[model samples]
Target chain A: MDVGPERNSLLAYARNWLVGLRSGELGVLPIIGGLLLTAVVFQSLNDNYLTPGNLVNLVSQGAAISTIAMGLVLVLLIGEIDLSVGYVSGVAAVILAQMLLPDGSDLPTGFALLAAVAAGMSIGALHGLLITKLKMPSFVVTLAGLLAWNGVVLMIIGSQGSIIIQDRAVVSLSGSYLTPDVAWAFFGILMVAYSISLVLARRNRMSRNLAVEPAALLLLRIVGLALVAGTVVSVANLSRGIPFVVVLITVLYVVLNYVLTNTRFGVWVYSIGGSIEAARRAGINTDRVRIYVFMIASSMAAIGGIILASRLRSVDSNVGGGSLLLYSIAAAVIGGTSLFGGRGSARSAILGALVIASIDNGLGLLGLGSGQKFTITGLVLLAAVAVDSLSRYGRIQAGRS
Target chain B: MTDAPLLELRGVSKNFGAVQALKDVDMTINPGEIVALVGDNGSGKSTLVKSVAGIHQVSSGAILLNGEPFAIRSPRDSADLGIQVVYQDLALADNLDVVENMFLGREQTNKLGKLDHNGMECRALEVLDQLAVTTIRSVRQPVASLSGGQRQSVAVSKAVMWSAKIVLLDEPTAALGVEQTRHVLDLVLRLGQQGLGVVLISHNLHDVFEVADRIVALRLGQKVAELDRRTATQTEVVEAITFGRVSSVPGQSGATTS
Candidate 1:
């Protein structure tokens, strides 16, 4: 009943959101709500849970899994799952460790990193080819990849126990932090970039006579982003500043979000995810898109593995084994990336990773065992999936009516 | 009718190992004309449409565009020649918004390789407006939220974009309700009036008679009759489909109504 002038107000925004809720368009609200609720509960259980130092540590701990989760979002978008991401990361970590071995080839750290990433990408491409060309399901192919890549890691390590990373740059990836000054400067740059993008997008929309968001709403969003960035930078700077791995993860998130939201390739990816037949009919190269997404997923997983290795200062047979794969997938799904695909974002990885990390951090502070952690995480994963399915069902019912 | 046909299929035949799906089919689609392709079950009407749309390579015969013979080896090739097909399923990504779906594969990008969202939205609006589609509330709304008729309109508009000169719609109104079917039939007529060669493949004689300028009937993998709407009767077209141009009662050609 209330339309027109009130449309530009925050009340209108809330009203629209309510309307969206009724229509079953539950965007990121659940994840954000879960995140806030978890943070409160954890902080209450452990007085140090929300401390700046612990929060910073939680971010660094989450970086590796979050990076892999971002990649998982891509694969999941196409209604496919990559089961071998853990082992793929393991293969890269092994390669990195071998390259930096004391009496070994002594390759440059940069080249070694590239080589590790390349290996991960190559494996991804192989998986993609098998899935697309041979018409095999991604689940089976990646499952086989999981086992095979694990074997490759074992073959490379060869009972050497664990290789300590002596390379300074490699060790610094997760172990070191940015200085306060550098962190502040980075935040400044981020704000400027965000502002410029917003302005440009508005201008572009206006020029083409496409509907632009109300200027007030636009400003509100920009200011909101700035505030969040400022708070994060300030909080991290309170201690040793943001860790390099945290920065790395943030950069990955930004770049990936840009690619997914701003590019033609991104459109094609979502289209294929939404309906492969529709994408094909629209003349998209679905095969190429699938192959490329797999490559990206594996490469990011490898990068995550590298970060994990850096955090531990070593690469061992157990580097990517255990519940790492499950955690990464849970992060993506819990962050709101739909298992049915075509409905997620790169930011989902970050939010989901933070949630998982909070649980781990809280449990660790409480002296809980790995069994408890797994159980709680598995429960959380199930709840997230249930929410996803319920929302989808609601959407379908609403559409039909 | 005076200009060269936009698309022409000559002696087209397609076989599936032991089964011949299409046999020596000849058809022409001219600009500014709506040709209704009427067929019964297993009538090879789909095969004929697919052959022209390059979904199936004809086992024999040639396809011409603007009176020039061209090889249509794949769907891409057909699309490249400005021939677009709106399949029975509609082939629309239900999750994507109207503009996104409209520009899915052929998305425009800026210099930085970012999707030109504004440009795409503008173009999509233009296309929809040209087709006089006003039922859709927002271009940003996902296709899943659309009514059946609205979805059909979006599919038609998408095909008409990218400078498409010919559009093949396979059973566009098959899944629609009465009102929705009427809306789709109106859209089909508008498409023909816009000077694009329109092919309406349908089972409903009412729809076929309403919008089609000419009627093409297929029966048992062959074109049984091609009749001009101005001169042909529905009974004649029905008879052609059921009996395949051969009157069982030899002397009752003009008088057989039952």
Candidate 2:
């Protein structure tokens, strides 16, 4: 193997993975440490914080915000933001509720869902058009959208405070769970597929004489994942089984991660985010890509809104009100997505959402109100950003090294 | 010298409002030739390159490619015509790796349309090997970490990767050290040997005279002089760049403004 002094050393690899001092990556240590730290603090306050049942409920609660944040990652990747996502999602939920109102159109659940996503897509397209064609700042355009879409929600849900969703399918979206047997089976399938791919990749590198992890280390990595997966499934069995909402969020993560890392469109999104001028010189249609990214952001927002409504079994003008939008954005940033663009992952959105949701979940158990929850969450967000900025400086120094 | 030129600019003029950036410019670049474009700052050297790259449509005249009239209305048209440019300040993204930057807009895709990473890596390796660029430690290393000369090499390699008939490099070695400058000069000569029309825009006369087959000078948006490198002296080229063949100026002292 063409192993340089630092390239093939298992110790170096592990250290780098932990701190990323020499690698430009944000690293896994801080994220894991933060999660564990949160667990410890909350568990001390309320013994229920670390329980299997509470943890499963946490995933269901985090799914919608995580999904919304995931969509925001696309926009963030290209160095933009969608302030209207919360309201866009709110509008979609209202539309879906109206479609499923039995006394009204009484549309099929699938069609109603499609319509919500479509509405989000159209709204995103509009935002893109105004931002690009009119040459308006995205901040202003999305800010206007935030207010305008909130108005749309209010107009649609006028007189009635909320549209209660009586449809079984819609309600089941957030409440449904996979049985223990099915959850375990799915976990098994995933582990098998994941292990095969990872093993084959290592073998491929070995064949090429590239530095690769030792077989023992590779096995350890696989075993580690297996343990985690086992714990999650076992916990789900202990609770009400694995929530389908969690599965949906995970599926979204997998799909988006693949798309961003492996597709032409995905590369362009990063390129545009990196430097629009450079991307333009490279013959990329920057405007078109930007528009599409916004569209994706909104479409995902629609899905998030649906999840929220499904959980509550209703939609109202206040669905996306208060700190939901800010929290969603916060979740993405806390998960490790950069605000300045050109760097982020779908994993960040979900992980960040999990962190945010945990704070809320833990606080609720202590009988704390939303005020305390918001204050703590806001402080956490600030700390995350401070670390991110510090890491950015470290990235620069690491690049020099 | 008997070969027909690959690119010809005839009386191409460009005006941005009342300010004329390029005026009545004429030039020719043939296969297996190196043309050095030299001038003071704002002397239409960049304007002419930008015009050819279709960043600014010529207000008048025509551009001929491969002896055929070619209309370049946008940068894409220029790229489609096998013309590539490595800009001075921003030819690459610092966050992306060499392979990603090299194949930014024109990524090779698989049957399912995902990035054909293996294919691209092989091709990238082949291209780097062809250029004899041994400085890069890994293709996966982000561009931000690369030395200035290494980044320049990747940018030039990107132009070569796309099968460009003509390559325009704007100040490729302005930020490099002496050794790096020598390396880039060698690469420019190598491009000429490979039968591509290479346009080297620079402020360094030593560099231009070292590799360029001919020097084209511009002054105040006009083509002032075209000289054969073998016959031309440094003074003559400098004079052409500053004075434009006019023995003396009527204005106070001979002010040479950038």
Candidate 3:
């Protein structure tokens, strides 16, 4: 064996691994491995668990929670919390349902959706303004919003208990699916476009003499993405089709994910979340960004409400309350985002939501009670937080050296 | 010489409710000079600097900037007039990279209106290079990952890059080690050499002797001495500043240079 070069490379790799471990980047491996192992175990427990139909159902159900979780992720990164998302969503649903009541309604379907989104955004902006301009803590402002918005929801619902959305167009939004052929075609187009963009971006960085990954690393990332895309498409082809919810989730993920990751707005979001004083000194209009962040959170929640109403065909006073809020926060946190702030991604919300949904799906199939599921979810959340805290401490200690 | 100073303060005082932090202080920094301001704790050195930085409003003062009558009501107002203050705390975000921290509030945008990171990184690298700062590794590295001296370097570069005609540094080398202190002192001299007025607040006489062209001493919010480097020795400057006179007479410290 060639001892010199091989031993040197091994030492280098070891050093890299140690650095990664300290930085929390290596933390993802164990989580991914655990998820894969869990999936295999569940699939063996019941063959149906791995079937295409159930998987599609699993992903579809995660879309709404994932969207709201994305917003919560932004808020949390800024070292703040919004406790009113559930009620804000419920109020938005109630308002939308009222607008959708057929006879000579003052607003059309598209206009009604826009109005509902605006109203949700306005409520969020109001909270942000009260906190930033009036110098109130966001926690208190959002808590007050929690009670106030729920009251508005109850008033909107009246004594009717439930308001059914008979609008066919709205129902079709989250319930229908594209044909199998169309789904495959669309998936093909997406894969090609994604690959091209990745390649072009790498090339641009290389030409500019900016630091980028080596060619081998870039190839590995592209190949990995290809495999994931191919697997998803194959599984979708085996099922009936791509559900409308999946398409909706994809659209939201792509748009918001890009805005959060690759743009100035994304940088501002992280900066504000990291340190308000630092961000302000950097010349960011912190006040404006704060108002906009809250607005986005409430608006996305409104969209989540629309999806909920579309799927359930009704809106009620108790639509979004305790459990939904808990699930949304859990989804963002369990996806590996930091609760202490300045670290997280929009993609983590989807992952966390999937994890939550998977547990719910698995436990329900095993005939477990709601209490059992709740206990299990709580345990998972605790474990995730523990991992995060431990790794952060490790990073700090390493940094001190 | 023109009758106008680069920055002038008259009767600048600040009160925190019942506590009198600063009382009727007067000072001046001329163009193309290094002025070292020194005092003991609670001796109103910080209050005077804060007033100049616009972090605190003076209860009473007539301040002038570049011979213009100016009232700095906020940090933004001070920044607009090219007044950069580097506090001992450094005011840097640890999680952000060097370039990000340097251009935190004043980032360059591209035609697409995105943060033109390429240009900013290039500019940040150039600025550091011009200052002959070779201690830092990568400009992309977060400030948290840097050494104490490196962070101070970046903070100084930020103040310098902002075109600050008058840079006020508060205990810039207090938290620094020996090597780091030397590096900062060298940077201060370079700033003065570039014809930028510098107001350095320090307790270290060695550092003051190494960089400052003149020393202005404050004792309890009152100007006690102004010693040019060529005209006075360290002992004489210290005696004049500390006791507010050169000799201790029977009744009072005699007002004469020993």
Candidate 4:
């Protein structure tokens, strides 16, 4: 339908779908297009919307929610949902805040962070136990988790309505920025790593007599990645350099992406999501895998919570409240991660979160109220899920999924 | 190859609360032999196979593997005992490729603990090619794209790839076409000829007669008869399955509980 010129051809693009849309392939283009559309609309309306300072702020704000959504991708992949992640993060923040209360017995930043993460893992393990061992529906268990964890947050944050984080190490995590030279060097290294990994993977497949992409295609891939990375770094260096939160999110994105795609545990997660009975028949420890997934989700929530507190320089009742949960979920869906599971990757979280943050940042620049932002964001989330369902149905109808 | 049976079930009985799903079912599967398990719907054929695959724990049974009693409390235990199963619905994840499905639980990893994708891809190709399952377009393509028979082949190939001592196929040809069924039957024969024990569970009498060396019939949670294919007729096997009438076949086990 998008028949254009050869140089900018949609027909060429459709033909080049290594995995086609009909097969329910989650292409990055659609989400990127949405982002571009938002940028154009917002920049035209407001002068400051697309400025470097604003863009850096947008990344920092979205980093926390994006990390949680990254974990949600795994949960969703295995056909489970964790409604408690937002509150789980809130609980994580409060724990860290209390541990660093400066009451003479206040622990150092490193130990406090570790303690918070452990708590997150334990909470996830508990949720997994309820779901797997008791044979309870994940929806019910996680719904209950949402309520109970929120109660935990409320109780923990009692008396004092908010706790200001005074530890320099804690506050500076999301507040700091990479120097301009470091940002450029970091981008260079990232591009090089990307290129090398692609080459190595292609070589690996080829050595096994499996099909490999052409050399030209591989080169083009590197070029594309370099272009994107270079543009972001250049723009970021124009402001107070790249935010530390951006670096943290990017590193995790790569690491988690690899974990989801290239490990035995990762394959098991996908299999369990695809078909639990089948995974069991295949002799996979489905319960163990489920448990691990929950733990990972909670740990990610803890990280997100810590990042948010660092960015704000304080922990409050709204650490994971308001649109945090909604944004985390919407980010995943908006980035083309299937709610039904067995699809999507870590990139979905990063891109989806960015898209969401961009919209929020753009609307705020136009003096939009929280009411309008919530409504628009909700509609966007709905649209994403609807699109996911339609594509899934198409794949099913085509007998390819 | 040897005198002793590779797998033997003695006085096996399984109960699901008030209902008895398998009652004192005794069976032997020797290497290089095809044992076709036959029964009408709800006749404990599935239950017996599932129990062997450790999907359900038997209430009372002595399952002997190479003359040693083994406990199969879970599918993992069954797998560790060199038992592989191609379930009735072909428990292959549609989202995964043939290589991935074949090595789902028992994935090969490199020294660094990352997946050895290259090694796995090679091995999957070797097994599929060894089975002569040439209908698949590509092993890299997800099983979802494969036809019913192709998916079935991948499932069967998965069982064989692991060098399983005994392969249990539950209704392998149920959803297949005529040609596909023949292909599966041929593969079953090949597996047995390759010195592996094959238990083919199906209700199709014709399919049973094609490649099975021995036919074991179940009716209402009990073994009605075990017949040698050389000596038993289709009518006799069907009668045993539908009505629990043990035939006067020469190699009949005479375990008629009814």
Candidate 5:
């Protein structure tokens, strides 16, 4: 297919996106807009908000919630919520801490972490079975799970104020940073891989007689992505370089995004979310998909718990308590994943996490209390939901006529 | 039309506890033929179609595909047997685009198990083009963005894409406007022309007259009359639906004929 001169321009692409937005296909526009606005406001209030060191800290601190939110995205895509995720993460952390205690079990750090993740996954599967096979509502099942898992955490942490992690490797999972050279190499590899994939996708489209994006536009996107990667790497290197947790989150984001966008399972998730009866009529194994999604959600929560423990160098009764679940859910929704399901990506979790972390960090810089931070976060989440509902309404109106 | 029937239902009966939705009903659909099942609101049209589509199991019946007994216990079983149902709702996911909805359950994947988006898009375009569906602006557009006729076209194309030999359409044009209804009726005729046996359950006698080669009328959970469209008049089909039998008097109203 010949690309017309007018259509080949970046301006044309932008206009197309605008047209889609006007028709109520909101995509990632709201999140991007919110992120930019927040950055401007926060940077104006506190110059430290935009500093390389502070930005690096924001990325590291956002890693746990961001990781957990990715799992929530999957669950949300299936039109389900895992209310127990917060407590599930707590249970995992408690187990990890107990296993790592100097006077406790002598399991290796890797084995202990694996055991914690496994426990979380098992709990998730149990929830899935109950919801799918027993025909129980996910909300009720997970709500019960929330209370039961919290009780287990209390039982495990009885009489102990906190368990300090002594394993050096476990501590480094979140506390360590990559060298500047390694960070630069990572950025270079990402750029190369991204470019190659773009070219290959274009080729595939051409071979299939499908319309391919103009070469100029494709190049423009590649360059744009590279610029973003370069800026992030440069900013991190200006400090102590990228934190290991940030790298971990980035890898998780990439993998989850690929799975959600490019795989058959991902399609099933969206289909089931869109309409369960439709999915069943299409001959999809809805029960299996729901089960796997719950498992993924809880396993991700377990990963978040491990990161939290590593960051604090200790696990306590409050490891995964105190609004962690709310924050993670808010991040997913605020990043653009529809709470109603079938309309989100792993990128939403990352973007939303960044927004939430920025708010918390900026408020901390201003010496504001947690109360103010909670109020602002709640407002932002409400605003995001409002946007989602309005856009959905608009789309429905458009479809009807 | 082929001599051998593609699908046959004998003594199909379904009971929802105290209510008998279908009782001792029989139907035979042939290849390259369009059979219209006309009925009133409570005449078991939906129940019969659902039974054939495996959404509901018949309490007692023998379903034959190619002269052999077939058991449809699930939608998957029906799909595997080349039976597809384009329900009134169309069953298209509003969030997914045309290609995604077309291949929802049976997605094509590459060697690495990733969805082969390019391949699916190519096949989707081919199928849509074959059906001459041009109203869709872009194959990537979500179903929610399409008109009623376009959504129906996608759903039908999805059924065709699965190589279905028998297609059951329940009120394919019920909620459609005049133009869209015409489009769907044309597609239904084309499906018949392509040698797929089509069972279209509709209330519109005009649509049934336009596409159906044979008309099956049902009333009170029983198949009342089977008329060849080439020989039977609209009045006769209506009589069968209302009174479960056609009046013998020519050019006489049912009241006078009785």
Candidate 6:
């Protein structure tokens, strides 16, 4: 056809843009285009929507969900799902609140945190053992866990109405902020460390005769990261400084992403999801990794529960029973992570959570009812699934052709 | 040459429920040699190799490594003794790159105990170079992206990288094109010359004739004959494997192979 050349050029441009997307980095085109679209639409609709305070509130509110989504990403990576994480978090928060009851009860705050983490881990281990050892499907086991944990929460909080967190340190964890100068100092230090690691990793790949990313690409990454760090610091400076919750979420994001991408455990997760037999042949203790993954997911839930309760200053029996589960899974999927597993990143969950929060915030500002919000979320979920399936089909077709 | 055979299996018998997969099979592999294991389907080639690689325990037999009796309690134990097996399907994770597949369970780690990608990748490249497998340009590329022959090369390299005393390659060229088969046969010879005892298991006589230094024939779970490559013809080895005995062959020994 006479239009073949034009079509070819369009395809070439698309290919180049696709190639630039990697884990932990947003493609520039989509990000820029999205920002422009948001500004155009929201700035015209509501004057207060794009203000710095609301933006700060958005980040703070999204952090807890994002942190929990990070853990859910791990569960999904190995081709498994933990339907109980939401309720587990709720139960964890309930327990934490109960521990701070009026009388001389339970352990200190630090010990209680550790104990909560342990409880979550044990529950996760139980799930793993049931799945692998008993040959029960994870979906079934986790589904049962979802109901069981919810029931436990109800039983624990029975007739007590709800418990409130009064500890100053615990409350400050979600509500407090750093001084402006200290926030900048910390941001600078983190950027330096990240840049150094990136450079060293690139060099290591080169030394191994592995294909190294182009110098320009690597430089672009460093500059991009520095800019992001600077932007975050400035945003915090605009508000009441960086919320301690943001700092906590950022630390978990960096550390957890590092473990998932650079470590053997991360590789094992993908390998198991891709092919369990292959992982076993490679001498990885798949059972152990599964157990460990569940533990990590549960522990994160415990941390999430604490933060959520601190933000609310109270926990009820039904705190995590409802839409939290769907939202967490949605966060993971919206961030472009695959549900079928062997593909995805922890960072995507954070990004996805932000996307979810944006939609929620935008709709709320527009005074949309819960039904309309649900419809929008459902449509987004369907769109994500469609994109995932199309891309997967494309890959398979490419391979076959 | 080493006075002791690198690996020796005596009366290795394995049973699966009611089926006698390998009934009293015996084989020996010396250092710096390529031994072809030829047999028909259900001829117990897999059973013999599996026993040697510790994937299955022999019901009754003595497996010796370097003239010392070895106990293979598990696959890890066999790997520790430098006995490696590369199966036909090549149990490699496609999502993982060549270096990751090669080092795999034995990935190199630095003092921090993290995956030493540099060390593993460097060692993998070196092993590929030693195998003379030049088809692949990037070791960082996932094994999924590789051609059939290249994947085979990576699998063979994984077995040979740790200085395996005996490397068992099962049907390395069975699924390959003619050109890939040639490349793989060359790799087999290269591995042998590198002083590792290589056992090439295949049904293709042409491939055996091309690279194997010796031929061991098995029929119906029993080793019937063993022939030196220089002394026996292709027809002679086939007859021995198919009929359980050599009717006419000049220089080959007549003793029971197992």
Cα lDDT for residue B231, model 6?
87
Give fnat for candidates 1, 2 and onward, in order: 0.82, 0.61, 0.34, 0.77, 0.79, 0.44
Q: What is the per-residue lDDT of model 6 for residues A229-309, given as tens digits with 9 covering 90 to 100?
A: 788778768878788888788889888987876688888887887667889988899999998888898888878888888
Off by over 4 Å in 4: A1-19, A101-106, B5-30, B54-77, B220-233, B243-258
lDDT winner, 1 or 2: 1
The lDDT, on a scale of 0 to 1, for candidate 4 is 0.87
Of candidates 6 and 5, the better by DockQ: 5
lDDT of 2 by residue, A161-247 (tens): 889999998899998999999898889888898899789877766666555666667777889989988998998899899988877
Task: Tell me the TM-score of chain B in each candidate.
Answer: 0.93, 0.93, 0.90, 0.92, 0.92, 0.90
Question: What DockQ do you compute for every candidate structure?
Answer: 0.62, 0.52, 0.39, 0.63, 0.61, 0.35
TM-score of each: 0.94, 0.92, 0.89, 0.90, 0.94, 0.89
Better of 2 and 4 by DockQ: 4
What is candidate 3's lDDT per residue for A1-401, written digit by digit as tens? 45576566666656877876767554455457646765886788878788889887777777778878888888887778999998888888888899988768557789888887888899889988997899899999999988999999999889889988998888988788888777777777877877787777777666777765455555666788778767876796688667787777778888888877556777777788767777876668988888888888888888887887888889887887857777888888888788988778888888888887787777777778989989988888898888778777777776721
* RMSD (Å) of each candidate, 1 decimal: 3.8, 3.5, 4.4, 4.7, 3.8, 5.8
DockQ (C-alpha) of model 3?
0.39
**lDDT tens digits by residue: candidate 6, B98-181:** 888887667666677677777777788788887888998878766766788988988888888877878999999989999988
Best model number under DockQ:
4
Q: Distance (Å) between predicted and true CA of A228, model 1?
A: 2.0
User: Which digits, one per residue and each the tens of the lDDT, describe model 1 over residues A267-302?
Assistant: 888888889999988778899999999999999999
Clashes in each model (backbone N, CA, C under 3 Å)?
0, 0, 4, 0, 0, 0
- Cα lDDT, all candidates: 0.89, 0.87, 0.80, 0.87, 0.89, 0.80
CA error at residue B75 for candidate 5, angstroms: 2.9
Could you tell me which residue pairs clash in candidate 3? A78-A273, A282-B104, A282-B105, A283-B105
Residue pairs clashing, model 6: none
Q: How is the predicted docking of candidate 4 categorized under the CAPRI scheme?
A: medium
